[model samples]
Each structure stands twice: as C-alpha cells, then as structure tokens.
Target: MSVQDAFAAPRSAVRDVNGGTGAITDTVINALKKTRPWVLFLAILGFIGAALTLLVGIAVVISSMMMGNLEGMDAEIAPFGSGMMIGVGVLYAVMAVIYFLSALYLLRYAGAIKRLSSSLSVADLEAALEQQASFWKLIGILVLISIVLTVVMLLAGLGGALFMGAAGL
Candidate 1:
C-alpha cells in the first residue's frame, strides 16, 4: 500500500474526532445561566444599599444642624452615626459575596469554553467565540456598576462626617 493509503486507513478507523458528546458545553452554559440571576440580584442589592447610605448621610447632616444649639448633648447624639456605619458594613458584605460568586462562575465558564473550543469544529468554535464575547460584556457591565456604587457610598459617608463636624455636634 502507498503511504497516502496507509494514512487514510488510520484516519478512517477513528471516529468522532471533534468530541461528539456535547455534555461539557451544555454543563458550562447551564452553570452560567444558573448563576446569572444571583449576580443580577446582588447588583440590584448594591444599588439599594448605596441609596440607603446616601439617605442616611443626608439625614445625619440635617439632624446635626438642627441639634447644634443644644448644650452638653454631643455624647448622647453620637449614637446617631451608627446608621451610616451599618450601611457601609452591609454594603461591604454584599460586595464581598458578589465578588466571590462571580469569581467561581467565571472560572467554570472559562473551563467550559476551553473544553468546547477543543472539541468543536471550526464553525462551531467561531459561534462559541461570539457567545463568549457577549457573556464577557455583561460581566464587565456588572463589575463597573458594583465599583461605582462602592465609590459613591464612600464619598457620601465622608461628606456626612465633614458636615456633622462643621455643625459642632
């Protein structure tokens, strides 16, 4: 037999070179979809926490101003600052949970993509690339929103503190 025929025989003997089983891709996609709702919920929660922090900060400033004229009341009114502190604490905790869950989801997604890419034909790989691009875009948006909320909360706390101190409370 010619060398060409020998190579052809071996190629024909093997089957499903492209990993015919679709289980790996399916598992990855399902995992991503499952985690999406949790991430979205966390994003909404973050926004709500930030808003609460801002409102609490504003209230503290206004309250301090109204009570400024009262004598020997500084120690008694100091407990009012607890609201802002609690808000910051809750927001930080929520952000930490979001970060942890997102990291896990991303790792799983990456593994799935790698497996699928290796097992798919050229055409299938191209399609997966497009899907992966969209997925990353969504994750990026979430990350940006999370960061913005954190920054705004921090600034609000700082502003409230400065305002309260200025009021002599």
Candidate 2:
C-alpha cells in the first residue's frame, strides 16, 4: 500500500498483495507455525529475566536496609547511601514489572497462534494479530522512553561539565 493510502485506510480496509481483503493463506499459516516456537521462547525468556530482576531488586532493598542498621557503619563508610540503594532497587522492580508485562503479551500471542493452528479460524487470526499489535505498541513506547532518557542524560552530563568548569573544578 502507498504511504498515503496506508495512513488513510481503516484497519478493516486492509488488503493483501492480491488486492483482496486480508485473508490467512497457507503461507501465512506456515509462517505462523514457524514463528510460534520463537515467540514462546521469547516469552519464557522474558519471564525468567523478569523473575531474576525482581529477586535482585528485593535483595538489594534488603541489603540496603541491613546496611542502614549496621552499628559500626557510618554513612561515609557505606558503599552506597541507603536512600540511593533503595531507589536503585525500586527502579529494578519497575523494570521487572515492565518486562513481565511484555512477556505476558508474548505468551498470549503464542496462545492465539496455538489456537489458530488447531482451528484455522479467522477469529483466532484476528486475536493473534491483536496480541502482536499490543506487543509492538509496548516496544514502541519503550523505545521512545529510551530515546528521551538518553537525551536527558546527555544534557545533564553537559550541564554538569559546564558547572564544574565555571566553578574552576
């Protein structure tokens, strides 16, 4: 589809290469079958990674708390201030949640493919597409966030450099 037409067309107006309403062809089915395993694998990996991250987050928080309670330790002696450690732990926990959600979306998409394999129903195909769309949407949002964060960090670094220079440091 032309770029103009693509933007103008509604989802229902989508057409296949043969200029017909998008239909699940045998090729499409085969592709889905081939890809299902990869999708499932990704989902499993995400789940595992998220679980590990969550564990790390919890451990970090506990360690920080324990460090704060140590009688012989002073703030200057601690590797990191308890507040900073807690903040890092919270960030890790938030990342774990995001990772888990991405994994959940992939798992649901895989399930849709499994159903389509068994039934070859248009409904199943639609469901699979919806799940796939959700996964892509999440990834797109994450990409945007990463870009913004990079820009912010760069600006902050530049600002710090200028400040240090002005202070004759």
Candidate 3:
C-alpha cells in the first residue's frame, strides 16, 4: 500500500465505523440487562460481607477485654494488652465501615442499572456508571493508603533491624 493509503482510512470507511453509535449503545444496554442478576447478587453479597466484618470486629474487641481479665498471663510474653486489642478492633471496625460504604455504592450502581433497564435513557446509564466509578475511586484511594503504610512499615522494620544489629542485641 502507498504511504498515503496506509496512513489514512477513506472517508467512507471512517463514516461506517463512526455510524454505529446507536447500535453500540443498544448493545451495551442489552449486555447490562443480561448482567442484572449478577449485579443484584454482588450487591447482596457485599452488604452481607460488610455486616459480617463489622460483627467480627466488635467480637474481637469484646474478646480482647475478656481475655485481659484472665489470670496467669505474662505481660512480657504476650505484648498485646486490652488497649492494643481495642486499637486493632477499632481499625477493623473502620475497615468494615469503608467496606460497607463501598458496598452501598455498588448497590446504588445496581439500582441505577435497574432504572436504566426500565427507562433506556443515556442519563440513567451515565448515573449507573457514575456509581461504579465512585466505588472504584474509593478502592483506589484505599489501595494508595495501604501502599504508603506498607512502605512506612518496611522502613521502620529495616531501621529497627539496623539498630538492633549495631547494638549487638
């Protein structure tokens, strides 16, 4: 093929490719309709998982307190006290809340999909996608925070190792 032909598609070809926006939209709508049941399942599972996580966190805190009251425990051997356990439990509870919020967003997305199935409007589809975006955005922010925490913890561990080595401990 000549360089000109290779570099550019004919206008007819371009128009043909660009002309199917409506078809594409219809295809997307159909696919979303087909996936409605799965989305509903996901929303239900997410809510259940969030609730379970919150309950587990609360249980951890309560168990830590009960364990603290037990006798014949060496503080040096078991460094975790009720205070530390409470902190850990609180962290778990916070995580549960974040999970629940994200799950709620997923539920919102599912609801939007249901609405779009009935209305078949671009606005409804956009609203559904927006909820999906919100859920992913929250997850992305949490992942970034986790990466920073991991790096900080690694550095702290390295520093401690160096200190201990230098001190001949």
Q: Give each model a TM-score.
A: 0.37, 0.81, 0.77
Ranking by TM-score: 2, 3, 1
The CA lDDT of each predicted structure is: 0.56, 0.89, 0.79
How much lDDT does candidate 2 score? 0.89
lDDT assessment of candidate 1 = 0.56
Write the residue-wise lDDT of candidate 1 on 71-104 in tens digits.
Answer: 6666655555554555555655555555554544
TM-score of 2: 0.81
Instruction: Name the candidate that leads on TM-score.
Output: 2
Clash pairs detected, candidate 2: none
lDDT score for residue 115 of model 3:
89
lDDT of 3 by residue, 1-169 (tens): 6456666755431211224442225567778888777877877887888888889889989988888887888876444787788888898889888878877887888899898877766678789889889989998999999999999999999999999999999
Off by over 4 Å in 2: 1-23, 76-80
The candidate maximizing lDDT is 2
**Per-structure clash totals for the candidates:** 0, 0, 0
Deviation from truth (RMSD, Å), model 1: 11.3
**Per-residue lDDT over 50-70 for candidate 2, one digit per residue giving the tens place of the 0 to 100 score:** 999999999999999988888
- By the lDDT metric, which is better: model 1 or model 2? 2
